[model samples]
Target: MFAGAAPLAAQFPSDSSEPLAHARELLRETPLVDGHNDLPWRVRELAAGDFDSLDIAVHQDSLHTDIPRLREGLVGAQFFVSYVPADLIGNGAARFALMQMDLIRRMVERYPETFVFVTTADGIESAHEAGKIAALTGLEGGHAIEGSLDVLRTFYDLGARYMTLTHWASHAWADAATDEPRHNGLSPFGELVVREMNRLGMLVDLSHVSDSTMMDAMRISEAPVIYSHSSARALDNHPRNVPDPILRRLSENDGIVMVNYSPTFISQEVRDWAVTRDSLVDSLRQAFTIVDVTAPDSMVVDTAGLRQAVAGWTETNPAPRAHLEQVADHIDHLAQVAGIDHVGFGSDYDGIDAIPQGLEDVSTFPAIVAELLRRGYSDEDVRKLLGQNFLRVLRGAEAVAERLQQEMDPIVATIPP
Candidate 1:
């Protein structure tokens, strides 16, 4: 997005006097509290839930995340994602969700020296003070609850502090950003879900929900909501990105939008290319051996054929490129529309295969902060963007939870057909 910006690693000077260096120093103090990272799901995919297969305690070139890389990035805390393929909605979503949570808990248990399990905002701070990476859990889709309030509460009790209302597909209660509007917005059950989330102190995530769903949840939620891994739609017009109006509404609701680093969500050209590619994949599904990729967990296609075909399509239609500056651009747009207090980092790492040009892995966060410095963002504002805004939102949710448990009754009402 910067006309001809240098590589991310080169953006900052090694010298301590430079502003970039100053930004790095600030990160050392507060550290980046990333809203989302999908290393757990990546482990599930690669090792079939075998925790011993991957040694994250050391550097893992296979992953976008590793201890060395996270330390280099100065990531103080992370919300490790428990993402199940949306197609598992009716089949084994709840079970899958539990398995993913179990994996995260096991990961923390295995690497106690590197990761400290954190559930509350206070715990996050305490872990940081103790010089450990605070590990928190977040469920990626509402389907993980299987439309049961009891299930939702159980997930909360299991250390999941936030749950995105939808993923790439719609569920019984909420609509997804990428799916055709089935509920138009939050169905009656969806509204009940939001209210229950508020009472339970769980942060209601709106990243994959449709705009109307976002509005509906914002209207009913007593606590602040979060766009855990979304960018600005006004910049790229992708459904997965948040619209400017919603950013405005976010400010009023006292929430934050963690900018997504996914190339399609950040670049209009890439989004356009993706639309065409998806159509081709659909056609392939019809012509060749079936693999309901729409339901990733259940996909049973000609893997060799589909992979080769998709690779060919990519070769023919080159995917558009995106850079960290564009990432900064989205951050700037969010701050401009929603105010600086409402913007933060939520890179969907490991969850996505494509990386923006300059943002290769966890180690590259300094370059992003350095670019923000080049854009003349004050050090304080940059710090807030890095992690403070998210921390504030976390603390706010804790306070809301306390007030809610005392002031309000849990919604046990169900949606009527």
Candidate 2:
């Protein structure tokens, strides 16, 4: 455990009137399934995919997730993301994704007592009943499939329950929210990707996809879609967030928008600060004739000079802190817009660099639950937000897949030339 971190029992007091206590009791009964986390990526980065070197059995200060912290958070099920960067589109993206998936499976195998590898809704509940965290896999970028439906099916067979259509950059078929539009939304092959996923019971995750792509998938997918780690754009105005129109559409589609805790996505102030920082960095790069301004740290040749310049900028204009309340506010907005049954937590724990104040790490989940309780959310409503809603979506996808499999063959089409 990190220094000064309270013990699991101590984190929740015994006072009957305390919401934290109530929240703890509720989570004990209901599985708190987080839609996304990136512990596998962290393991791959820090230890070169060696779980023994970077042990999660005990507290590791460098990471946001650990076995002890997950237990304290009462996280019954977690989707460990196999995140391949957009830069790796055709350059062995599938291999990297497979490696990350292997890492998650190995983690589960390494700690059998703490985690149970689960690919179905029933498996999640069974693992939770047995007092184990259900470790599930998710593929973050569709580019990892290399424009092939067969590869997508293979990923599902390998235990990827959900696959985010795009990452930071748009690829051949899908348009990423952060990148310029190519196919305008999803190409013909992209629509087939959604259809194939529906037929295979894999949840279509729209977190980093563009608005058009999100709408197209929502229209094409027979199963309910999910923004696995997105906040309400009506709150923060970030492209990565779900807009009000999309939230309203969830009611008809019966999908869920798992709120993200990333400071830039949840806080308007933080979003604006990032915009200003990026603009300043770009201007500085132009002034210095730096070709690779993307490398923010020591990897670039302008390590010393650029660091000095950015350091001076930071000294004058420090970034504002994002509070826990701001995260709750986004959740509240999502519940209001998407309806109570359509919102849940997707705390992007290890995936994000900066976290909100109260939600510092995985163990801080109860704090958000307590905040919801304090804000007048009933126990039943809170239960839906915690995990029931996500499970319902998963079950919906499974049912859709079962029905579709009887009517359709595997999608064998390739990207059109």
Candidate 3:
């Protein structure tokens, strides 16, 4: 249906690698839906939310994503993230989330020829058939709701298909993977949030939550949950990655864990190197404190000196580079533990600073497809990884929502002050 668009098979020349040519052919037939991307946040940070300032229609050297690269990647659909900082919990977080959501909407409006705003599994397919990319939105933190089910409902109405329960810090009702456990898991209100999300056909994303929180949400959610952007913890031991136990439970819960491409999450060596570097930087900061600290307990360090010290240390001890093979290893591990139907991709592109070697930008997705093919993955299995798995989960949530809406009322419970 794409007039003047090159035929799928003709996109690759005869000189292209056999696996790469095959990978591109497979992607054209199947919608390669990425679970998470932070282009909206990148635009907010770099362009002050002005699409004109950083036009994505052409190549953008400064960012990992743009329309040209996404087309090169053959990405059929993408979940544009409306990520609010964890610190915004009580201080107008809901408003900030609204602004981010509005930015996504504006993006669709501005690039109507290239993007089709989609909220359902079928919508993605429709967009793909029309040779346009489907643009969907996902909230990156539960803190964006500010502990209110009403706000959660409003976000779903605004087209948020999923929400990570927490970011780097634990909030009022949920524990974060990177923070001290306050709620242990989901608090009473957090459980209610999951239930309400199920009823609304919105996905319960467990990417940044603690293990306890993952277990709690998995046990409570009627709809299948998703790790919008995470890797396998069994491989790297990063708190941000999913453990084998959770991966095992995915089949029973009928959930999917979209493997992440972040270097720290994919490679154990890289993660360890980061930890040591951070410790060294912290020690260096202790010796060069700022003269005027505004907060009594805060120790502000001279950033210039810290940067120089870290640069020197990095020069001496270069960090290990994670590669495409390591990413495939994570995907292979997830499929081994969680089953093939539950494995998918959520590259965390534009959200992370460091990326795996070959998977440097959005255009590199075909390289992953080629890697998996070389590893003996059947085209059918690779198709599932590309987008079928996520489509199944999306439809599953929609089915559950249809059933729940007929039986239950909207949750109005609020967290007690």
Best-performing candidate as measured by TM-score: 3
- Tens digits of per-residue lDDT for model 3 on 364-415? 9999998777666777788899999999999999999999999999999887
**Tens digits of lDDT, candidate 2, 146-181:** 888888899999999999999999999999999899
Better structure of 1 and 3 per TM-score: 3
Q: In candidate 1, what residue range of length 10 has the lowest lDDT sum?
A: 1-10
Point out the worst 10-residue segment of candidate 3 by lDDT: 1-10
Model 1 residue runs over 4 Å out of place are: 1-17, 283-310, 413-417
- Report the lDDT tens digits of candidate 1 across residue range 251-298: 778999998999999988888888999999988965667646688666
- Candidate 3 residue pairs in clash (backbone atoms < 3 Å): none
Question: How far does residue 86 in candidate 3 sit from its true spot (Å)?
Answer: 1.1
Q: Could you tell me every candidate's TM-score relative to the true structure? A: 0.90, 0.93, 0.94
CA-lDDT, candidates in order? 0.86, 0.90, 0.92
RMSD of each: 5.1, 6.0, 5.1
Candidate 1 or 3, higher lDDT? 3
Which window of 10 residues has the lowest lDDT sum in candidate 2?
1-10
Clashing pairs in 2: 1-59
